[model samples]
Target: MMFDPFGDFDTNGYLQNSLRLKDPLEVKESEHLAFEASLEDALAYLAKRKSIDYKAVLKTHEILFSGFYHWAGKDRSELVPHLAVFKGSKDDPRHTIFERPDLIRRSVEYALELAANKKRFRERPGEVMGQLAFAHPFLDGNGRTILLIYMELCYRTRFAIDWSNTNKDDYLRALSDEIQNPFEGHLDNYLKPYLLDISSRDEWPEMIGGIKGLDGLDKEGITYDNLDNPEVQQLYKTYRSQRID
Candidate 1:
């Protein structure tokens, strides 16, 4: 689950970072630092936006991680259309199968489509989140990027979740379950209790900067396989069947 998508881990470090840091801890430190520096700007940028789309989503990822990853904004379709990304060993029952490269855009668009109905989105933010998480558009920085997009969606809709109160372990568990069982309200059930009136965007810089484990899903248990693998192909078909429309 090292996520050596570029196959240059030994020489260029994880995802060929700017400093070529090899240790996972070093990589984590560098990424989190970069994420913190960009959080305020990212929040402010979202504050000005009237709406967001896949381009905005990619831009958010670029803004947050460009300092760490040269290919920060590019999605899987552009970077590695031939490989499939997963959260665990492909054969494992709990492993996650992200959207295929060709369908990544469709996945995000669908999430946005769901968010268009602000009332429904307010009630079932998890469905939107689960869709984006399933897309897994970027090689890295996906969790943080999607959070920014999700925040903007929440702000536009005038609602928020108390990330401060939510346990990272429980949230991730619900997200994983939600991804596997899309539209079943797994994430909505978990998030409903934490829903509250939206907080000031000014408070977000510190609040988001203080939240831990934003990278929990990104840093570990990531592996990739060739799209041609029969098992991998079968998994995509299964998940595609679950996709609405």
Candidate 2:
């Protein structure tokens, strides 16, 4: 089943988009265009911030996607608090489970806390990325939103990722493994070779927008269930008890 948390797909599309587009292809084109247009505004917003917190994360999503999504800045916790979102199926042992709605901010906050230790963040950027990706704060635009935030964090920390040098499928596989088996450095190993010196903030809009597969790490084949559902509750146990060597 598709992840339609809004429960309006039959009439409104995967999301209640700006132009009421019901076709997936059309919605994607329009949404991608809006995202391209907003990159500068989003970066400008981040550039003004003296410090970042969970609230800054929300605002960055708003600026980047408010043109396309009516529910742009709001997270799943506020919009669909009872639903627990996942990739693949809840019953599958291999599925990717995001943080529960109630814990979304806490997860992002933890990522920010980890980022505060600049040394740890630089040494294990994948761990930081994995944590934020697990937060899964928004209904859409997550990959781009998180990239912007991650870029800001990198800029502040004096390091950068050579995104162009990485492969999408490999990066995503590593990220999924990282979320499922966190702190063991699965993603860190994947990202280490791509780490490089920081680039100018002004170069980001063109450089990031020109890149391919930025959205590949985001929503696709997603499904959701009531938090009270037994299987859904069981799946969260993996996250609750996660630790890896």
Candidate 3:
């Protein structure tokens, strides 16, 4: 069996759960582990996809036990929006991320509005990603989910935002701005650097290379050089490294 780094036996999910609980033991540790793994995988897959499909989103939780808590149990008909409801208990530690239910709904609606207006105006993808995170929709995986969704949207619509250029401080500033003035100032500020980078046609090969390899590959495919512009010897090395008969 493929080993899951954040699985039932680990505390990664439990740590997240402890935030909302007065007594951390209130949450079932086993269930938290299972859900955490599923959520992480879903976020990772969504980040890599070119476009958002409700089908793929739904499938992310189909096999999990408590996943149905958020989605209507066996009700596959209702589409899951890229930014949607987080149905964890308020008393649970998970509530820390989403303190107000109204804010969650507002964030979802705002994200939908952003998506709808993406083509009408030249909006930076990073700005949208930042706004989604500000929404903090999901109790657990809001950051991961929003980033993936924003990237996927940009990849399909041709407004990719690479965070490689800016430091974490700048990125967080943009997100903070969105919370204060989501309609105008903050969104643009956070996204401006990323937008400039995208427009400039600069590539950050190292960060892209370091991304986790496609699932099931024997080699992780993480290397420092630009594989796209590999030297003759490097090409030969890469060719030899692949599993071949």
Candidate 4:
């Protein structure tokens, strides 16, 4: 029975993969490089797209992590199929169940809908983020993936978070709280003070990389969704058509 929560890894604790890193530090370095490269791909993709949606979210993940994980573009519902959570407080923290696999598409589409409205996105960015975070679509790369997508959403709205000035501890704590009580806007309150006029997307990767990348949130393991029915395709189509290309 394998007991590693991070999936397959070498004896030295590095993620088992082509780069053959020997430890967490080394693995992080490799992932940073991969993220930097993918950030460019994501920017190019966003430039060509008419609007963002759940598929764009998946493409962002695929662009960022495809070099590292074979399942980069696939969400946990498709790859890991089961109930998973961020374990805490006596080994079981209170958590809202993640969107079941069959509902993943619809859940993300809903988030995209919230994000597409500039006024609502600016007023309730945390709610939009929390909904997507609760969805927890992918097994790995959720933080990085979501951050990039959120930034893109902000770009579309003509705003940006001056992440350089944001405190990591406060942001993470608020994120956890937001995840626990999504509609309260705790994360938005924390982030709103840092919001600024839009900036160049080209600078985002390094700016994000400087913040230490995605760390401290991986305890939540991947899970699968056994729900049989899928919805949201039609809704997504209607939503996409309504956007002002």
Candidate 5:
């Protein structure tokens, strides 16, 4: 019952890795490099796709972390069905239930549908982004993966978040608020000020990397091996069948 997911540090207190690096700083540095290198390929892959669905979301995760984690493209439900995850501080923890994994798929699909509307995408990016964050699909890397996907959605709709203008603390706070009260638009309001016309994608990876590489509000992970049941698997199959690509 290890409550801290990122606390699985090796002897040196560096986070343990699916890859060989044992030094925490080295692991962090390597992951940053991996993300920057993979971001272009991920964006290119997105360009060929007609829509961003759950599969595309998984693909983004894969592209971003495949070099660092063998389980990059998989969801928490599949990898650790019995595990529970939480974000936020000890006093006000936000729990994520892996019991009903299909909800993750539904949330992403719902976000994509909302994003399909240029008006809603422009006016309520927070709502869309909040839903995806609430879904919390992966064991880790959800923030970075979703941010890229969110940016891509904006690009398709002809808009982008000026990451340069955004403050990391403020953005994280807004996202936390949105996660807590998802239907509300706290994140949308926070982001509205920074939303700008679509700009070059070329510098986005470097820009986002500098802001707070792979940082997310979610905290803690504990695994329970027997969480998945037949019904959930069926739901996943149904969702998988609906993917556009």
Candidate 6:
């Protein structure tokens, strides 16, 4: 989904093989519902836990990984034995998952602050993702977990993520820069263009009409209400134009 419409990347067939549901209706009714519910739980748990309970994140991780591994036919507990946090031996580059937990923590903290300070920013979602990725909190499903976290946050906060319009090369590159670079200059530079582009749109059709123009595949479970918001409508128009090109 990320690579196909926007890039020349080849399809892997992984999802086609893994998704065994019968039809689009089955997908919308069962798989998507379960997936969405699990995501909401994860995001709410992370948000409620961030300030009051350090253990909350780990508990949230357990639920998230367990559901993911259950779907994947793998053992969740074995993949991540403990709650990951910034500082300690986990920061060693040789260890892999624990390497640079501090950086992950910093990113999480910064994203959380942004959510708190900005009217448009989604709380818990981006921060949880930034935190989990930086910590490499789990051995498996980190990517999915982070993405779900982001989605749930966006849904709760009403800021839609333009995943359909996003370029995976650019998105992954920016994530890598934040994880690898000491100065972290490239990370912000990468996301800045996306932010500016979406915010630049001048006008849009009504939500009912505008969102109807999006690729059905791109809609996921995103609501017309999200598109109805003035700011979100602008973004929808901006992304729709990009999709057109």
**Considering lDDT, which of the candidate structures 4 and 5 is the better prediction for this target?**
5
In model 6, the clashing pairs are: 90-98
Residue 93 of candidate 1: its Cα lDDT? Answer: 89
Output the better candidate (1/3) by lDDT.
1
lDDT of 4: 0.68
lDDT of 4 by residue, 1-245 (tens): 21143555555243333475655565666766787777778778876789888888899889988887666888866765543433242123443345555567887888888887889889877878777876778766778888888888888898888887877768867876876666677988998898888756777767776674364244333332223323233322333353323
- Stretches of model 6 off by over 4 angstroms after superposition: 1-37, 40-56, 67-132, 151-160, 196-245
Better TM-score candidate (1, 2): 1
lDDT of 1 by residue, 1-245 (tens): 36798998999998999999888888888998898888877877777877898888988888898899899889999999999999988889899888889889999999999999999999898999999999999998889899889988987888887888899889989999999888888999999998888756767776676566775458688989899999888898887677553
Predictions in order: lDDT: 0.87, 0.86, 0.40, 0.68, 0.69, 0.38
Candidate that would win on lDDT: 1
lDDT of 2: 0.86
lDDT of 3 by residue, 1-245 (tens): 21111232253333233332223334444434544556445555654655554344334434332441333112211322222222232233322122133344455455555665666324545445545554553333334344445545555555665456655555555664554344556656656656532432224233332333211121111111122333523433432343121
In the range 59-126, model 5's lDDT, one tens digit per residue, is 99999988877778988767655644444222223433332454668778888898988897898889
Model 2 residue 67 CA deviation (Å) reads 0.9
TM match of model 4 to true structure: 0.77
**Deviation (Å) of 96 in candidate 2:** 0.3
Off by over 4 Å in 5: 1-16, 20-23, 89-100, 213-245
Give the per-residue Cα lDDT of candidate 6 at 63: 64
> What TM-scores do the predictions have?
0.96, 0.95, 0.46, 0.77, 0.77, 0.40
Per-prediction tally of clashes: 0, 0, 4, 3, 1, 1
TM-score of candidate 2 against the unseen true structure? 0.95
lDDT of 2 by residue, 72-191 (tens): 999999999999988887677788898999999999999999999999999999989999999999988999999999989989998888787788889889999999989889999999
Compare candidates 1 and 5 on TM-score and give the better one: 1
Model 2, runs deviating above 4 Å: 215-217
